[model samples]
Target: METNGKILKAGIILIAVLVVLGYLGVYLLTIKEPVFIKHYIEEQIYTGYQQGPRQVDLQLYYITNAGDNRVVSRVDFPEYPEIQVPASEYGMHGGFMTYTSGPQQTPGSVKGRYSMRTVYLGFSFEEDYYEETIEITKAVIHLSDGSVVETEIGSVTFHFDEERSEVLESRGGSGSGALETREFSVKEDIELIEVFSPILPVIQDSLEMKINGRDFKDIEGMNIEAGETFLVEANTQGSRGSQAFGEELRYLKFQPKLRFISEKGTEETRILVSGWYPIPNYEFIEIFQYLRQKGAL
Candidate 1:
């Protein structure tokens, strides 16, 4: 009986030792293994080549891990967010074009700058959307620990057309007959790049205007007040082509209508984009935060 008890005790000790060894192997292989994960960027700096008026390619990129997992992302401007580029600063020969007020043909573009240090990316809105730049209007990023970082996604500003042409809006002079006519000095290549009506559907025919005073025998079908420079465009036949093309739009033409009116009256124009316009300002901290939240950097 004593010999059998000794053998049982020995076997129990051996099993306990084997169990401890198995646990140690697992701990060393997985539980205690150091994970060396890092963020790898293809380019330290990003530049977007100009595509056309009111549109540019953001150079989309993919986030990849050593395991070959990937996520795709691209930069974009907010929908009709208010843009305020001051004149004499962002190269705005014409300054501060807002949805409610500002110069016609305000120039600007939205750009993005990314960083891993912050929870967000950086943004720069410039005047001449064609120029290559490091400045951005939005910034975004994320870290390994699951902490998020980001900033304002993008911005828009106004600029004056250096090549703007002169025009005349006249309604009859000293004449027995009453007449109204618009005259243009030359062609005005006003590019309407983006539109945003957050509160309403993106209506293509919400307003109307006549370009270069070419036609306006009382801009019928509008409820605009006489002597009101604002001409409400009830029909934007010219912009329809752009709408049909959708995201594939390159450029479109617009004849400047001196006046605009909407069925709602007191019409407002909301377009947001980024680029150095009028001048340059280095304000792009908010955009970075936004990018991280969306997992776009």
Candidate 2:
């Protein structure tokens, strides 16, 4: 009886040891490694001239390894610098409203693409014009590897126009008071390329803009009336190449400024706009297809 009991006890110990070893092996195999995120800006569009809400569109791309490796949780873009202008200038003001987009969710394996839309409010005046460039300095990506990578993208130019009409005796208005209407068209010309190790430039084949504008209210204290509307749009393309691991780089940064100048009764104003975007590879391919269809290639 004593011998039989000893054999049973030994067998139980052996099974327990095997189970522990199996668990350890599984844990090691499931361990995750740091992943590389290739970021790209697909498209950016801005429409600044409108009595109603202006619009801005940003398309972004995120790429990673195709496995249970580390995933991208958050991407931190540099804050757009503040623009300080006096309130008394032009008796008008301009700014942006709360923008909307899908919640920044966890990145999946392979690639993830997203688009964000922002609404802007133009200055309160009969007519307003604006011109600016959107530049992205660098994007700081947080990885499950407990690592952060800063990468440089590029810049793009944008223009804005806002027009309002005074109620003439012909139009329906009380005592020459004009009512604003939402109506405008946008035309854009943009070319963008991803500069990795080997630089290759790709021009945008399509130059037609098809974005419209909507009505908005005065959020800023600029006491401006709503009227006519205008729109802005940018269509871009991107390609990928190998990049060196460590290198000094200069990224496009967002630093917006507004200046009102009046020379000899000629009034002029300058506005600055900046942001970041990521274009997916499929979208880039579609751009080429579009160009070829139009015989632009």
Candidate 3:
């Protein structure tokens, strides 16, 4: 009985060792690489890519170095979520992508290889209805092995035409020039990109602007709806006349506080997207909290 007990103990130890080895093998053999999507990127950088229920074309390029069985399956854009297309439509007929935003155009000759192939992946929008300029920097690629990849497609813009109009009421002269306020309602959603400050004044100590009553964050771009409030304290220049010889010949000087794009149509305000996410101003936030604690804001 003692000998049998000893043999049973030996068997248990061996099984435990085998199980650990198996786990280690599996872990070491797993793949950990990202898929890639490329375009026939020009010096133009794909400007005015467009909002679609309409079709457009580009030499869809792809690279799948993810794993042994991995193959390009699909490509898509996040900003315009409606657009998605198969990785490659390779058959006896050649190109597989037959559909686009509206019309069908034969894809150019397939290019590149398995490790890094620049094939003409038939591409188009499934359905997108948007207005204004869009910045495209990333593309998500789907792989045949059931994994997804987010790769850079470089900088690009969409639907970038605009219209500008004077719509603010100035109350009095204060901050840098005159304090201006606009009580406006958006007919649709407005995605704000920048707070347009005509002339760059030494504005560090002064409050820049506020939207929906939030305070350094507006420069990062935001979204708003009806009754959206825009408040600015200064404008160093650009008002036709005050009380001078040109008072009668006033050149309606106007400066837009919030530069944005909405569903109704594209309005004025030159756009510059520095970063997508907000870069928090810790000092400003802390100061604000302290001020509110003393009823200073």
lDDT per model, in order?
Answer: 0.28, 0.29, 0.41
Tens digits of per-residue lDDT for model 2, 46-155: 34343543434332233222343444444555643232112211112231232349633333323212111111112221122244433344555555567776644343
* Comparison by lDDT, 1 against 3, better one: 3
Candidate 1 lDDT at 127 equals 47
Worst 10 residues of 3 by lDDT: 271-280
Q: Which ten residues in a row have the lowest lDDT in candidate 2?
A: 191-200
Q: For this target, which candidate reaches the highest lDDT against the unseen true structure? A: 3
Off by over 4 Å in 2: 1-57, 68-73, 78-131, 144-146, 154-158, 163-201, 204-297
Q: Give a tens-digit lDDT track for model 1, residues 86-148.
A: 112112222223344644331222233221111111233444533432223343323333433
Q: Where does model 1 exceed 4 Å of error? A: 1-160, 169-203, 208-297
Q: Pick the candidate with the highest TM-score.
A: 3
How big is the positional error of residue 211 in model 2, measured in Å on the Cα after superposition?
Answer: 20
Misplaced by over 4 Å in model 3 are: 1-31, 35-53, 60-69, 89-94, 97-114, 119-130, 160-297
